[model samples]
Target: DAGITQSPRHKVTETGTPVTLRCHQTENHRYMYWYRQDPGHGLRLIHYSYGVKDTDKGEVSDGYSVSRSKTEDFLLTLESATSSQTSVYFCAISRDRGTGELFFGEGSRLTVL
Candidate 1:
Protein backbone atom coordinates (compact mmCIF):
# COMPACT_ATOMS: atom_id res chain seq x y z
CA ASP A 1 0.00 0.00 0.00
CA ALA A 2 0.96 3.64 -0.35
CA GLY A 3 3.07 3.16 -3.41
CA ILE A 4 3.30 -0.62 -3.47
CA THR A 5 6.44 -2.72 -3.24
CA GLN A 6 6.45 -6.46 -3.31
CA SER A 7 9.51 -8.58 -3.57
CA PRO A 8 10.36 -12.04 -2.32
CA ARG A 9 8.44 -11.69 0.90
CA HIS A 10 8.60 -15.47 1.15
CA LYS A 11 9.37 -18.31 -1.20
CA VAL A 12 10.28 -21.98 -1.25
CA THR A 13 10.93 -23.54 -4.60
CA GLU A 14 10.90 -26.98 -6.14
CA THR A 15 9.10 -28.83 -8.87
CA GLY A 16 10.92 -27.27 -11.76
CA THR A 17 11.64 -24.01 -10.08
CA PRO A 18 11.89 -20.61 -11.68
CA VAL A 19 10.01 -17.90 -9.84
CA THR A 20 10.35 -14.19 -10.04
CA LEU A 21 8.06 -11.66 -8.47
CA ARG A 22 8.79 -8.01 -8.08
CA CYS A 23 6.49 -5.08 -8.23
CA HIS A 24 7.70 -1.67 -7.32
CA GLN A 25 5.63 1.42 -7.74
CA THR A 26 6.24 5.02 -6.89
CA GLU A 27 2.69 6.01 -7.59
CA ASN A 28 3.13 6.26 -11.28
CA HIS A 29 -0.12 4.41 -11.45
CA ARG A 30 -1.42 3.79 -14.91
CA TYR A 31 -2.64 0.38 -13.89
CA MET A 32 -0.53 -2.66 -13.08
CA TYR A 33 -1.74 -5.85 -11.55
CA TRP A 34 -0.95 -9.51 -11.01
CA TYR A 35 -3.00 -11.35 -8.51
CA ARG A 36 -3.22 -14.92 -7.33
CA GLN A 37 -4.60 -16.08 -4.06
CA ASP A 38 -5.77 -19.60 -4.08
CA PRO A 39 -7.96 -21.43 -1.55
CA GLY A 40 -11.22 -21.28 -3.36
CA HIS A 41 -9.92 -18.97 -6.07
CA GLY A 42 -10.51 -15.82 -4.09
CA LEU A 43 -8.44 -13.61 -6.33
CA ARG A 44 -7.68 -14.48 -9.91
CA LEU A 45 -6.24 -12.28 -12.66
CA ILE A 46 -2.59 -13.05 -13.27
CA HIS A 47 -1.56 -10.29 -15.56
CA TYR A 48 -2.20 -6.63 -16.29
CA SER A 49 -0.47 -3.55 -17.56
CA TYR A 50 -2.00 -0.53 -19.14
CA GLY A 51 0.89 1.72 -19.81
CA VAL A 52 4.53 1.06 -20.16
CA LYS A 53 4.81 -1.57 -22.82
CA ASP A 54 1.13 -2.36 -22.53
CA THR A 55 0.04 -5.87 -21.59
CA ASP A 56 -2.91 -8.09 -21.05
CA LYS A 57 -4.02 -11.57 -20.02
CA GLY A 58 -5.91 -12.36 -16.90
CA GLU A 59 -8.24 -14.82 -15.31
CA VAL A 60 -5.39 -16.93 -14.11
CA SER A 61 -3.41 -16.59 -17.25
CA ASP A 62 -1.93 -20.02 -17.85
CA GLY A 63 1.47 -20.47 -16.20
CA TYR A 64 1.78 -16.71 -15.59
CA SER A 65 4.25 -14.24 -17.00
CA VAL A 66 4.18 -10.45 -17.13
CA SER A 67 6.43 -7.45 -17.42
CA ARG A 68 6.26 -3.67 -17.64
CA SER A 69 9.08 -1.85 -19.31
CA LYS A 70 8.88 1.04 -16.86
CA THR A 71 6.60 3.43 -15.04
CA GLU A 72 7.62 1.95 -11.72
CA ASP A 73 8.02 -1.61 -12.91
CA PHE A 74 5.90 -4.73 -12.57
CA LEU A 75 7.07 -8.24 -13.15
CA LEU A 76 5.77 -11.64 -12.23
CA THR A 77 7.13 -14.83 -13.66
CA LEU A 78 6.88 -18.50 -12.88
CA GLU A 79 8.40 -19.87 -16.02
CA SER A 80 8.46 -23.47 -14.80
CA ALA A 81 7.15 -23.63 -11.33
CA THR A 82 4.12 -25.71 -10.59
CA SER A 83 2.45 -27.76 -7.92
CA SER A 84 -0.88 -26.32 -8.46
CA GLN A 85 1.14 -23.15 -8.55
CA THR A 86 1.28 -22.79 -4.83
CA SER A 87 -0.38 -19.48 -3.75
CA VAL A 88 -0.27 -15.93 -2.44
CA TYR A 89 0.94 -13.31 -4.85
CA PHE A 90 -0.40 -9.80 -5.12
CA CYS A 91 0.76 -6.61 -6.71
CA ALA A 92 -1.79 -4.07 -7.69
CA ILE A 93 -1.96 -0.45 -8.70
CA SER A 94 -4.57 1.61 -10.33
CA ARG A 95 -4.85 5.28 -10.89
CA ASP A 96 -8.22 4.88 -12.43
CA ARG A 97 -9.77 1.85 -13.98
CA GLY A 98 -13.34 2.99 -13.84
CA THR A 99 -12.82 3.79 -10.19
CA GLY A 100 -12.12 0.20 -9.25
CA GLU A 101 -9.49 1.56 -6.93
CA LEU A 102 -6.61 -0.82 -6.25
CA PHE A 103 -3.33 -0.28 -4.49
CA PHE A 104 -1.81 -3.34 -2.90
CA GLY A 105 1.56 -4.92 -2.46
CA GLU A 106 2.57 -6.70 0.65
CA GLY A 107 2.30 -10.25 -0.47
CA SER A 108 4.55 -12.69 -2.21
CA ARG A 109 4.37 -16.17 -0.83
CA LEU A 110 5.26 -19.00 -3.12
CA THR A 111 5.72 -22.60 -2.25
CA VAL A 112 5.79 -25.30 -4.85
CA LEU A 113 7.02 -28.68 -3.81
Candidate 2:
Protein backbone atom coordinates (compact mmCIF):
# COMPACT_ATOMS: atom_id res chain seq x y z
CA ASP A 1 0.00 0.00 0.00
CA ALA A 2 2.73 2.40 -0.88
CA GLY A 3 0.45 5.03 -2.40
CA ILE A 4 -2.99 3.87 -1.37
CA THR A 5 -5.01 4.00 1.84
CA GLN A 6 -8.42 2.54 2.58
CA SER A 7 -10.37 3.46 5.70
CA PRO A 8 -12.72 1.33 7.70
CA ARG A 9 -10.90 -1.82 6.56
CA HIS A 10 -13.64 -3.87 8.16
CA LYS A 11 -17.28 -3.01 8.57
CA VAL A 12 -20.47 -4.68 9.65
CA THR A 13 -23.82 -3.08 9.00
CA GLU A 14 -27.43 -3.99 8.64
CA THR A 15 -29.31 -4.07 5.38
CA GLY A 16 -30.73 -0.82 3.99
CA THR A 17 -28.09 1.23 5.78
CA PRO A 18 -25.76 3.53 3.97
CA VAL A 19 -22.07 2.78 3.81
CA THR A 20 -19.15 4.67 2.42
CA LEU A 21 -15.60 3.50 1.82
CA ARG A 22 -12.73 5.84 1.28
CA CYS A 23 -9.58 5.29 -0.77
CA HIS A 24 -6.65 7.67 -0.70
CA GLN A 25 -3.61 7.42 -2.90
CA THR A 26 -0.33 9.29 -3.04
CA GLU A 27 0.88 7.99 -6.40
CA ASN A 28 -1.20 10.60 -8.20
CA HIS A 29 -2.22 8.13 -10.82
CA ARG A 30 -4.57 9.34 -13.52
CA TYR A 31 -7.04 6.53 -13.08
CA MET A 32 -8.60 5.11 -9.94
CA TYR A 33 -11.05 2.26 -9.79
CA TRP A 34 -13.38 0.59 -7.30
CA TYR A 35 -13.95 -3.15 -7.50
CA ARG A 36 -15.79 -5.67 -5.42
CA GLN A 37 -14.88 -9.32 -4.94
CA ASP A 38 -17.43 -12.02 -4.32
CA PRO A 39 -17.39 -15.80 -4.33
CA GLY A 40 -19.11 -16.47 -7.64
CA HIS A 41 -18.76 -13.18 -9.41
CA GLY A 42 -15.03 -12.91 -8.96
CA LEU A 43 -13.92 -9.26 -9.19
CA ARG A 44 -16.32 -6.74 -10.65
CA LEU A 45 -15.82 -3.10 -11.32
CA ILE A 46 -18.17 -0.79 -9.46
CA HIS A 47 -16.96 2.59 -10.54
CA TYR A 48 -13.94 4.49 -11.74
CA SER A 49 -12.49 7.97 -11.97
CA TYR A 50 -10.23 9.29 -14.64
CA GLY A 51 -9.50 12.66 -13.19
CA VAL A 52 -10.69 15.01 -10.49
CA LYS A 53 -14.44 15.42 -10.81
CA ASP A 54 -14.41 13.07 -13.81
CA THR A 55 -15.93 9.73 -13.03
CA ASP A 56 -17.82 6.97 -14.75
CA LYS A 57 -19.98 4.01 -13.88
CA GLY A 58 -18.85 0.45 -14.38
CA GLU A 59 -20.61 -2.82 -15.11
CA VAL A 60 -21.84 -3.19 -11.55
CA SER A 61 -22.64 0.45 -10.96
CA ASP A 62 -26.12 -0.26 -9.72
CA GLY A 63 -26.56 0.42 -5.99
CA TYR A 64 -23.20 2.14 -5.90
CA SER A 65 -21.97 5.69 -6.32
CA VAL A 66 -18.52 7.19 -6.48
CA SER A 67 -16.94 10.61 -6.23
CA ARG A 68 -13.50 12.00 -6.74
CA SER A 69 -12.77 15.50 -5.63
CA LYS A 70 -9.01 15.32 -5.89
CA THR A 71 -6.40 13.34 -7.72
CA GLU A 72 -5.49 11.32 -4.68
CA ASP A 73 -8.87 10.52 -3.12
CA PHE A 74 -11.80 8.43 -4.30
CA LEU A 75 -14.96 7.68 -2.41
CA LEU A 76 -17.46 4.85 -2.86
CA THR A 77 -20.88 5.08 -1.31
CA LEU A 78 -23.58 2.48 -1.08
CA GLU A 79 -26.77 4.45 -0.87
CA SER A 80 -28.63 1.58 0.76
CA ALA A 81 -26.56 -1.44 1.49
CA THR A 82 -27.94 -4.91 0.97
CA SER A 83 -26.92 -8.39 1.95
CA SER A 84 -25.86 -9.02 -1.62
CA GLN A 85 -23.49 -6.11 -1.28
CA THR A 86 -21.44 -7.92 1.30
CA SER A 87 -18.05 -8.27 -0.29
CA VAL A 88 -14.45 -7.19 -0.17
CA TYR A 89 -13.79 -3.92 -1.97
CA PHE A 90 -10.51 -3.06 -3.56
CA CYS A 91 -9.08 0.22 -4.78
CA ALA A 92 -6.74 0.16 -7.71
CA ILE A 93 -4.60 2.83 -9.30
CA SER A 94 -3.23 2.98 -12.80
CA ARG A 95 -1.63 5.54 -15.04
CA ASP A 96 -3.49 4.28 -18.08
CA ARG A 97 -6.29 1.87 -18.65
CA GLY A 98 -4.58 -0.15 -21.35
CA THR A 99 -1.35 -0.57 -19.47
CA GLY A 100 -2.50 -3.78 -17.79
CA GLU A 101 -0.74 -2.76 -14.61
CA LEU A 102 -2.80 -1.71 -11.63
CA PHE A 103 -1.62 -1.01 -8.12
CA PHE A 104 -4.24 -2.24 -5.71
CA GLY A 105 -4.85 -1.44 -2.09
CA GLU A 106 -5.09 -4.13 0.54
CA GLY A 107 -8.88 -4.13 0.56
CA SER A 108 -11.94 -3.03 2.51
CA ARG A 109 -14.11 -5.85 3.75
CA LEU A 110 -17.75 -4.88 4.17
CA THR A 111 -20.40 -7.20 5.49
CA VAL A 112 -24.03 -6.24 5.25
CA LEU A 113 -26.26 -8.32 7.40
Candidate 3:
Protein backbone atom coordinates (compact mmCIF):
# COMPACT_ATOMS: atom_id res chain seq x y z
CA ASP A 1 0.00 0.00 0.00
CA ALA A 2 1.15 3.54 -0.71
CA GLY A 3 0.17 5.56 2.38
CA ILE A 4 -3.42 6.79 2.55
CA THR A 5 -6.61 5.46 4.15
CA GLN A 6 -10.12 6.39 5.28
CA SER A 7 -12.16 4.98 8.12
CA PRO A 8 -15.74 3.84 8.62
CA ARG A 9 -16.34 2.60 5.10
CA HIS A 10 -20.05 2.89 5.89
CA LYS A 11 -22.03 5.22 8.10
CA VAL A 12 -25.66 6.17 8.74
CA THR A 13 -26.67 9.39 10.43
CA GLU A 14 -29.79 11.35 11.25
CA THR A 15 -30.58 14.71 9.75
CA GLY A 16 -29.10 17.82 11.43
CA THR A 17 -26.67 15.77 13.41
CA PRO A 18 -22.92 16.16 13.54
CA VAL A 19 -20.55 13.56 12.18
CA THR A 20 -16.83 13.32 11.85
CA LEU A 21 -14.84 10.97 9.66
CA ARG A 22 -11.17 10.24 9.96
CA CYS A 23 -8.50 10.05 7.32
CA HIS A 24 -5.07 8.71 8.17
CA GLN A 25 -1.98 8.64 6.03
CA THR A 26 1.50 7.31 6.54
CA GLU A 27 3.00 9.05 3.51
CA ASN A 28 3.77 12.23 5.47
CA HIS A 29 3.15 14.01 2.24
CA ARG A 30 2.53 17.73 2.24
CA TYR A 31 -0.89 17.59 0.64
CA MET A 32 -4.08 15.99 1.94
CA TYR A 33 -7.55 16.33 0.48
CA TRP A 34 -11.16 15.42 1.10
CA TYR A 35 -13.61 14.93 -1.70
CA ARG A 36 -17.18 13.80 -1.93
CA GLN A 37 -18.61 11.78 -4.80
CA ASP A 38 -22.23 11.93 -5.79
CA PRO A 39 -24.08 10.53 -8.76
CA GLY A 40 -23.93 12.59 -11.95
CA HIS A 41 -21.40 14.95 -10.43
CA GLY A 42 -17.67 14.66 -10.27
CA LEU A 43 -15.79 14.46 -7.00
CA ARG A 44 -15.99 17.81 -5.25
CA LEU A 45 -13.28 19.04 -2.96
CA ILE A 46 -14.37 19.70 0.59
CA HIS A 47 -11.08 20.78 2.09
CA TYR A 48 -7.34 20.25 1.99
CA SER A 49 -4.20 20.75 4.02
CA TYR A 50 -0.70 21.69 3.06
CA GLY A 51 0.88 20.67 6.35
CA VAL A 52 0.05 20.07 9.95
CA LYS A 53 -2.32 22.86 11.11
CA ASP A 54 -2.10 24.41 7.67
CA THR A 55 -5.37 23.98 5.78
CA ASP A 56 -7.92 25.79 3.70
CA LYS A 57 -11.42 25.52 2.32
CA GLY A 58 -12.20 24.13 -1.07
CA GLU A 59 -15.03 24.50 -3.57
CA VAL A 60 -17.69 22.68 -1.57
CA SER A 61 -16.59 23.55 1.95
CA ASP A 62 -19.84 25.02 3.23
CA GLY A 63 -21.14 22.41 5.65
CA TYR A 64 -17.85 20.67 6.09
CA SER A 65 -14.67 21.61 7.89
CA VAL A 66 -11.30 19.97 8.49
CA SER A 67 -8.41 19.81 10.90
CA ARG A 68 -4.88 18.45 10.70
CA SER A 69 -2.87 18.61 13.90
CA LYS A 70 -0.48 15.87 12.95
CA THR A 71 1.42 15.08 9.81
CA GLU A 72 -0.30 11.70 9.54
CA ASP A 73 -3.83 12.59 10.54
CA PHE A 74 -6.54 14.74 9.02
CA LEU A 75 -10.08 14.88 10.31
CA LEU A 76 -13.22 16.07 8.52
CA THR A 77 -16.25 17.20 10.43
CA LEU A 78 -19.74 17.61 9.09
CA GLU A 79 -21.26 20.37 11.18
CA SER A 80 -24.87 19.55 10.48
CA ALA A 81 -25.57 16.34 8.69
CA THR A 82 -28.35 16.17 6.17
CA SER A 83 -29.79 13.65 3.76
CA SER A 84 -28.23 15.66 0.99
CA GLN A 85 -24.87 15.02 2.55
CA THR A 86 -25.15 11.31 2.08
CA SER A 87 -22.51 10.27 -0.38
CA VAL A 88 -19.21 8.49 -0.76
CA TYR A 89 -16.34 10.41 0.81
CA PHE A 90 -12.81 9.94 -0.34
CA CYS A 91 -9.53 10.97 1.22
CA ALA A 92 -6.68 11.71 -1.14
CA ILE A 93 -3.00 12.55 -0.99
CA SER A 94 -0.13 13.38 -3.23
CA ARG A 95 3.43 12.30 -2.63
CA ASP A 96 4.61 14.95 -4.99
CA ARG A 97 3.95 18.66 -5.08
CA GLY A 98 0.74 20.14 -6.48
CA THR A 99 0.56 18.31 -9.76
CA GLY A 100 -3.16 17.71 -9.25
CA GLU A 101 -2.87 13.92 -9.56
CA LEU A 102 -4.05 12.31 -6.30
CA PHE A 103 -4.05 8.95 -4.58
CA PHE A 104 -7.49 8.02 -3.25
CA GLY A 105 -8.71 5.92 -0.38
CA GLU A 106 -11.29 3.16 -0.90
CA GLY A 107 -14.10 5.56 0.12
CA SER A 108 -16.53 6.02 2.99
CA ARG A 109 -20.25 5.77 2.40
CA LEU A 110 -22.41 8.07 4.51
CA THR A 111 -26.17 7.83 4.61
CA VAL A 112 -28.27 10.44 6.35
CA LEU A 113 -31.90 9.99 7.25
Candidate 4:
Protein backbone atom coordinates (compact mmCIF):
# COMPACT_ATOMS: atom_id res chain seq x y z
CA ASP A 1 0.00 0.00 0.00
CA ALA A 2 1.08 3.56 -0.55
CA GLY A 3 0.41 4.78 2.97
CA ILE A 4 0.70 2.08 5.58
CA THR A 5 3.46 0.56 7.69
CA GLN A 6 3.57 -2.06 10.38
CA SER A 7 6.56 -2.50 12.65
CA PRO A 8 8.14 -5.67 13.98
CA ARG A 9 6.81 -7.69 11.03
CA HIS A 10 7.47 -10.75 13.12
CA LYS A 11 7.84 -11.21 16.86
CA VAL A 12 8.19 -14.00 19.37
CA THR A 13 7.65 -13.64 23.08
CA GLU A 14 7.05 -15.71 26.18
CA THR A 15 3.78 -15.88 28.00
CA GLY A 16 3.07 -13.18 30.60
CA THR A 17 5.31 -10.73 28.77
CA PRO A 18 4.26 -7.50 27.12
CA VAL A 19 4.28 -6.69 23.43
CA THR A 20 3.45 -3.68 21.34
CA LEU A 21 2.87 -3.23 17.60
CA ARG A 22 3.02 0.00 15.71
CA CYS A 23 1.12 1.06 12.58
CA HIS A 24 1.86 4.10 10.52
CA GLN A 25 -0.14 5.45 7.65
CA THR A 26 0.60 8.21 5.15
CA GLU A 27 -2.81 8.23 3.45
CA ASN A 28 -4.16 10.82 5.87
CA HIS A 29 -7.42 9.02 6.18
CA ARG A 30 -9.71 9.57 9.11
CA TYR A 31 -10.14 5.87 9.84
CA MET A 32 -7.49 3.44 11.00
CA TYR A 33 -8.13 -0.04 12.31
CA TRP A 34 -6.28 -2.94 13.89
CA TYR A 35 -7.40 -6.49 13.31
CA ARG A 36 -6.22 -9.96 14.25
CA GLN A 37 -6.50 -13.04 12.06
CA ASP A 38 -6.60 -16.60 13.29
CA PRO A 39 -7.34 -19.96 11.68
CA GLY A 40 -11.03 -20.33 12.34
CA HIS A 41 -11.93 -16.92 13.58
CA GLY A 42 -10.70 -15.28 10.39
CA LEU A 43 -10.33 -11.57 11.07
CA ARG A 44 -11.56 -9.67 14.09
CA LEU A 45 -11.22 -6.00 14.83
CA ILE A 46 -9.20 -5.11 17.91
CA HIS A 47 -9.51 -1.34 17.85
CA TYR A 48 -9.87 1.69 15.62
CA SER A 49 -9.37 5.45 15.56
CA TYR A 50 -11.36 8.00 13.65
CA GLY A 51 -8.99 10.84 14.41
CA VAL A 52 -6.11 11.89 16.59
CA LYS A 53 -6.52 11.02 20.25
CA ASP A 54 -9.85 9.36 19.48
CA THR A 55 -10.18 5.59 19.64
CA ASP A 56 -12.65 2.85 20.47
CA LYS A 57 -12.28 -0.80 21.32
CA GLY A 58 -13.43 -3.61 19.08
CA GLU A 59 -15.08 -6.93 19.73
CA VAL A 60 -12.06 -8.88 20.94
CA SER A 61 -10.32 -6.11 22.83
CA ASP A 62 -10.20 -7.76 26.22
CA GLY A 63 -6.41 -7.94 26.57
CA TYR A 64 -5.43 -5.39 23.98
CA SER A 65 -5.11 -1.62 23.94
CA VAL A 66 -4.74 0.98 21.18
CA SER A 67 -3.72 4.59 20.92
CA ARG A 68 -3.67 7.20 18.19
CA SER A 69 -1.93 10.36 19.17
CA LYS A 70 -1.42 11.40 15.56
CA THR A 71 -3.48 10.86 12.45
CA GLU A 72 -0.76 8.90 10.71
CA ASP A 73 0.15 6.65 13.62
CA PHE A 74 -1.74 4.02 15.55
CA LEU A 75 -0.38 1.69 18.19
CA LEU A 76 -1.62 -1.61 19.54
CA THR A 77 -0.39 -3.15 22.76
CA LEU A 78 -0.87 -6.45 24.46
CA GLU A 79 -0.70 -5.87 28.19
CA SER A 80 0.25 -9.49 28.96
CA ALA A 81 1.15 -11.79 26.14
CA THR A 82 -0.52 -15.17 26.03
CA SER A 83 -0.54 -18.16 23.71
CA SER A 84 -4.08 -17.48 22.66
CA GLN A 85 -3.12 -13.99 21.57
CA THR A 86 -0.83 -15.30 18.87
CA SER A 87 -2.05 -14.23 15.45
CA VAL A 88 -1.47 -12.00 12.46
CA TYR A 89 -2.19 -8.35 13.08
CA PHE A 90 -3.10 -5.98 10.28
CA CYS A 91 -3.57 -2.26 10.02
CA ALA A 92 -6.06 -0.85 7.59
CA ILE A 93 -6.90 2.63 6.38
CA SER A 94 -9.99 3.87 4.65
CA ARG A 95 -11.50 7.17 3.66
CA ASP A 96 -15.06 6.06 4.02
CA ARG A 97 -16.08 4.72 7.37
CA GLY A 98 -19.01 2.70 6.10
CA THR A 99 -17.42 1.35 2.98
CA GLY A 100 -15.62 -1.94 2.56
CA GLU A 101 -12.74 -0.55 0.54
CA LEU A 102 -9.53 -0.30 2.56
CA PHE A 103 -5.78 -0.38 2.17
CA PHE A 104 -4.02 -2.87 4.42
CA GLY A 105 -0.44 -3.00 5.49
CA GLU A 106 1.83 -6.03 5.44
CA GLY A 107 0.72 -8.05 8.42
CA SER A 108 2.66 -8.38 11.67
CA ARG A 109 2.92 -11.90 12.97
CA LEU A 110 3.27 -12.54 16.71
CA THR A 111 3.96 -15.76 18.52
CA VAL A 112 3.63 -16.46 22.21
CA LEU A 113 5.23 -19.48 23.75
Best by lDDT: 2
- Candidate 2 per-residue lDDT, tens place, 47-104, comes to 9999999999989999999999999999999999999999999999999999769999
TM-scores, each model vs. reference: 0.32, 0.96, 0.95, 0.96
Quote the positional error of residue 15 for candidate 1 in Å.
Answer: 2.3
Q: Model 1, 55-100: lDDT tens per residue? A: 8998878988888999899899989998998999999999979988
lDDT of 3 at 21: 92
lDDT of each: 0.89, 0.94, 0.90, 0.93
Give the range of the ten consecutive residues with the poorest summed lDDT in model 4: 94-103
Winner on TM-score between 1 and 3 is 3
Model 2 C-alpha lDDT versus the unseen true structure? 0.94
In model 2, which runs have C-alpha deviations exceeding 4 angstroms? none
Q: What lDDT tens digits, residue by residue, belong to model 4 across residues 1-113? A: 46799999999999999999999998899999999999988889999888899899899999999999888999999999999998999999999787778889999999999
Task: Kindly report the root-mean-square deviation of model 1 from the true structure over all alpha carbons.
Answer: 11.8
Error of 1 at 61 (Å): 18
For model 3, residues 84-110, the per-residue Cα lDDT tens digits are: 899999999987655787888899999
Model 1 steric clash pairs: none
What TM-score should be assigned to candidate 3? Answer: 0.95
Displacement of the residue 94 alpha carbon in candidate 1, Å: 0.4
